[model samples]
Target chain A: MDEKKLAIIATKGTLDWAYPPFILASTASALGYETEIFFTFYGLQLLKKDLDLKVSPLGNPGMPMPMGMDKWFPTLLTALPGMESVMTSMMKKKMASKGVASLEELRELCQEAEVRLIACQMTVDLFDMDPAAFIEGVEFAGAARFFEFAGQSDICLYI
Target chain B: MADFDEELDASGLNCPLPILRAKKTLAGMESGKVLHIIATDPGSVKDFEAFARQTGNELMESKEEGGKFQFLIKKA
Candidate 1:
């Protein structure tokens, strides 16, 4: 196969929504593809120091839980004590059962592959997120700047 | 005795993380060495399968038993 460059646009903040771009971008990098991940809208939460810490399962209908509980659990499960951790644990267990990697592992891969992670400046300003809340080394830029980078990519994904 | 020789416990991470970890782990492996990864993310079943095709990692096996995800990946 020919060498390819992939550009990932991570656009959501939920745990389920947050992981794909990071995973795909990392794999693309591993597969000898140059990769760039641009986080916009709620997607910037994944790069936040505290956001990824708490994965809210709001509006998650397919979330797996003990006793198939996620299916019947109240929509407000995210607000219950230890629910996020339980949910994150449930998610982690589910992913592990599927041969998926860990969050810690992904962080290392992001670093090792030098995956360029950028946060959309407009989203941050609109959300009123403190600049200091994000992970270190996040490239802060505008949509035009990000598109300039994506223009050169062979794969462009929005998620 | 090598890092590549052991099973990688990637269980408990969400999507993309499981795949990301596998990629990094595979990087240090010699081509043809088998790397094991265990995850608990349901999305991983799809994520890893897609990852295998994209990265050319031979996903020799993927099984989900009692809520645990397991795989034997051969570095290509």
Candidate 2:
């Protein structure tokens, strides 16, 4: 059977939110499928060296620590820690312990697996991002081109 | 092969990884070849179940071990 093409549209900017697309795409590639990830809006941040680790705690009441810390100081306490790495590291470790690969490894595998990573040029300018800040091997495209890319996908996921 | 025909040791992988691997592997097989996949990721349990339903893959068996998950899938 011919391998199907898969596309994952990433719009979330947080580290936790960022994992699914790379994970799915890399996994798809491992399965011998053609995979692509179109990063737009906040999703573009994942490719940026500086913004790869920041994540919002929305929908996670148990987040921001101490088990009930969000209630007391609010999730703002998460900002107080000032280290997205601490939370992100813990989260990645948890995911890894569950047999999930780390985000860094996943990204590498996605690249190695030939999962094409495309960044939306419009969103880059909208957010005022430096194209150089993103990881290597990313191509810039407009929505029309992305639509054409996505139209060929057998499975398309938005995460 | 027995009714429980094949086994895939895919422990220590998470979420879409297990299912994606399963799908990729399944796409190449003759129909009705059963595959059993063992995984340590809880998310894979749900992921595989949903994948089976969406893609018309048949899940012949599923189980767990101290946080690990096992599946018997028949390619459809």
Candidate 3:
């Protein structure tokens, strides 16, 4: 059988949203699939150096509290000032306790597994972000290159 | 211990780590070498089977003992 190819488009910047693409890319690579992730728009934030990713629970009613807190409390708390940072910290702690790898760890694993990381050139220009601001091993490309990968991929995801 | 070429204990790791480490380990070993892995994650059962199928490795043995999942994979 031919090796499967996977191409993922990552367009979200938040901490919670960042995990899905990286997790999928790394897992797919582990499965011996040719995997690449195109980071565009808000997803460009993930590749930025020293970027502090945060979770915004405000207006997000689906945020689950591991302690099984009622939705009302989180809804009310998220409305308070600085609550997003608080929620982000809480979520990180919860993830750590669960033995889940951190984003940095996952990024390293992706690199080790040879998963290609592509940063959108247009997004960098639009956001006024320097290409040097991104982590190492990132290739800069436009949507045309992304499409080329997507066209041939067995699994294509826009997340 | 000598029965397997490499022993990977992914006991506490979740989701892709078990499979990721196993894949990395397998990459370093010669073909026909067996890798023994112990994992506590319930998802590992399906994950390993799928990994074996996708990578064309042979899953020689898979069993559950005392809540831990054990697997023996022969690298192809």
Q: List residue ranges in candidate 1 displaced over 4 A.
A: A51-58, A70-86, A93-99, B1-76
User: What is the TM-score of each candidate's chain B when compared with the real chain B?
Assistant: 0.89, 0.84, 0.95
Give per-model TM-scores: 0.64, 0.67, 0.95
Comparing 1 with 2 on TM-score, the higher-scoring candidate is: 2
Q: What is the DockQ of each candidate?
A: 0.33, 0.36, 0.87
Model 2 residue A134 CA deviation (Å) reads 4.3
Error of 2 at A2 (Å): 10
lDDT of 2 by residue, A1-159 (tens): 577889888998787787888877876675557888889898887787655565545446656553555677555455555446666667766666777666777687688677889999999888788888888999999878778868988998888
Every candidate's CA RMSD = 5.7, 4.6, 1.7
Candidate numbers, best lDDT first, in rank order: 3, 1, 2
Cα misplacement distance, residue A59 of candidate 1 (Å): 3.0
Q: Considering summed lDDT, which 10 consecutive residues are worst modelled in model 1 chain B? A: B1-10
- Candidate 3 retains true contacts at a fraction of 0.85
Best by DockQ: 3
Rank by TM-score, highest first.
3, 2, 1
Greater lDDT among 2 and 3 belongs to 3
Question: Taking the tens digit of each residue's C-alpha lDDT, what string does model 2 give over B1-76?
Answer: 2365556677777666677667656766789988878787777777777777666778777887677788888987
Interface RMSD values for the candidates, listed in order?
4.7, 3.9, 0.7
By TM-score, the best candidate is 3
Consecutive 10-residue window with the lowest summed lDDT within model 2 chain A: A74-83
